[model samples]
Target: MVVRIFGISIVVTVISLVVAYLYGGVEALILCAILGIFEVSLSFDNAVINATVLRRMSEFWQKMFLTIGILIAVFGMRLVFPLAVVWITAGLNPVKALDVALNPPADGGEFFPDGSPSYETALTAAHPQIASFGGMFLMMLFLNFIFSQREITWLSWLERPLGRAGKLDQLAVVVASISLIVAAEFLTDEANRSTVLLAGLLGIVTYIAVDGLGSMFEVDEDDIDEAAASSGGGPSQLAVVTGKAGFFLFLYLEVLDASFSFDGVIGAFAITSDPIIIALGLGFIGAMFVRSITIFLVRKGTLDDYVYLEHGAHWAIGALAVILLVSLKWHVNEIITGLIGVVLIAAAFISSLVRNKRLAPEADAEVEKSTPVS
Candidate 1:
């Protein structure tokens, strides 16, 4: 199962490495490898979070995530999305943007000899809007998770209080809205304030629309049992999603992937400005690796095994959202961003180990009592 899941990722990595070496010699190969590592480290938490959602999906949609989802992640988010951003935000046509992306400015830097910004420059220039939108979307996700009254929590003291406050209806939305307002009002300059606000608002709206639709289509437990009874069968353990629910879920995941890549996409330029190379690293290898981890976790029921894993992922997301908002005011290193997530997840894993050890005796007691004598 592991080999089957990683087969595609292995194939993509070899192809991308060959392509990268061909594109810009050994240097390009090295840069591509670095970006792959960078993305994987930064997004390990993404896999944990994705597993929480992906486990509920049916087998068909899981396959969809492996296939069509990869195409979208590779081409749509890694390739066309950047072009679209350059087109809309930079006021360049799609073709013009592609041309600029493909061919650097004559001087071989982020500016033309005539003093106009290069393609990389244009994309980076739109950082405020990108950060605001992606940050707000992720902030809402993190807030929703923290406020959700889940049975399990890693930091019981903090999460318990937050969950209690979550009883206030629409608290996530109200808090997210206020965060967006504060960010736009204080973090952005006058020239970019309205644009930032608009982008941030759109982020919130997009999250609500996608998440709400997915939730609306989800089958209730009682309904699932009733349907099974009508068909003359016992209640199935699995609530396998299909049709509209699956479709919206797939859409929601893609949006989530896009949101996570905002800082990553921008950070790639700091290493290398070649979009082809970025796509080779992020789309081909990095994103593939992340998804592979997600599938492994789902197949293994890792979330159930490690009780606090989901909480750790959500906290990492909250930290990233805060970092993104902070970036609007001051630059934050990509290394710093990635390290924080890695550390949190590692700590969570260790804590889960401790929890298992503590419960081992109790689990043994229960098993011994239930056993029958010969």
Candidate 2:
């Protein structure tokens, strides 16, 4: 399974190298490899969270994720989305933005000869908007997930209280809104303040809207049973309905992917301002590996085995959200961002190992009791 999964990564690496070599010789190839690794490291938690959702999806939907979803991830989020942002924020047409992105000036200057902002410069200027939106969206996701009712918790001390607070309807929204307003008013620059605030508010609205839609469309077990009875459908047919219930989940996953990609797209500029390299390196290679990891986790039931994995992933997400917000005002090293997630995930994994060890005896005893007395 590992070989099967990483086989594609190998292929992607080779293709990326070949393209990079053709683009600018050894230096470009090396940079592309580094960028791919950077993306993978940064997005490990994304893979884990994706697995949690992917496991709930139907086989058809899972296949869609690998096929159709990858295209969206690679092209839509990596290439078009960034271009759209440059278009909207920099006051350039799509053609102009694409041209500037593809051909950044030699001096890495902010402007072209015609006095228009370069694509890289425009993208840098638009950071506040991207950061605010992605940060708030991710913050709400973490807040809502942590605040929701759950039987198992990795961080019981904090998560339990949050879960209790979640009983107050729309508490996540209230918290997110407050956070956004505070960041915009206090932390943001006076010039970009309105854009930041608006983007943040829009992010919150987006989260609420997407979540509400998911809830509205989600299929209940009772509804499935009732439908089966009415239609004289058997267990297999009921299972099919249950599987198809993942339609909303599929949508949620795609939105989640977009949210995560925001950071990756922005961060890619640190390596090279070239949009094509960013798309190929992070979008194609890194994202493909992430998808493979997600599929691996689902097929192996890794979440069930490592119970705290989801908890750790969410905690990492919360940290990343906070970092994204902070980055609007302060420069944060990508290394710091990556390490915090890696450490938290590692701790949660170690804790899971300990928990399983403690639970093993109890499980064995229960199994023995259930067995026939030979």
TM-scores of the candidates are 0.95, 0.95
Model 2: CA > 4 A from native = 234-245
Q: Alpha carbon lDDT of residue 11, candidate 2?
A: 90
Instruction: Tell me the deviation in Å of residue 230 in model 2.
Output: 1.3
- Candidate 1 lDDT tens digits, 1-374: 99988888899899999999999999999999999999999899989988988998888888898789989988898888888888887677888888889888866877767665677889888899889889989999999999988787899999999998999999999999999889888888899889989998999999999999999889877877777777677544333444678889999998999989888899998898889999999889999999999999999999999988888999999999989988888999999999999999999988999999999999999999999988
Q: Which ten residues in a row are the worst by lDDT in model 1?
A: 234-243
How close is each model in CA RMSD to the real structure?
2.3, 2.0
Best by TM-score: 1
lDDT of 1 at 239: 36
lDDT per residue for candidate 2 within 73-101, as digits (tens), equals 99999889989989998899889889988
> lDDT (CA) for every model shown?
0.89, 0.86
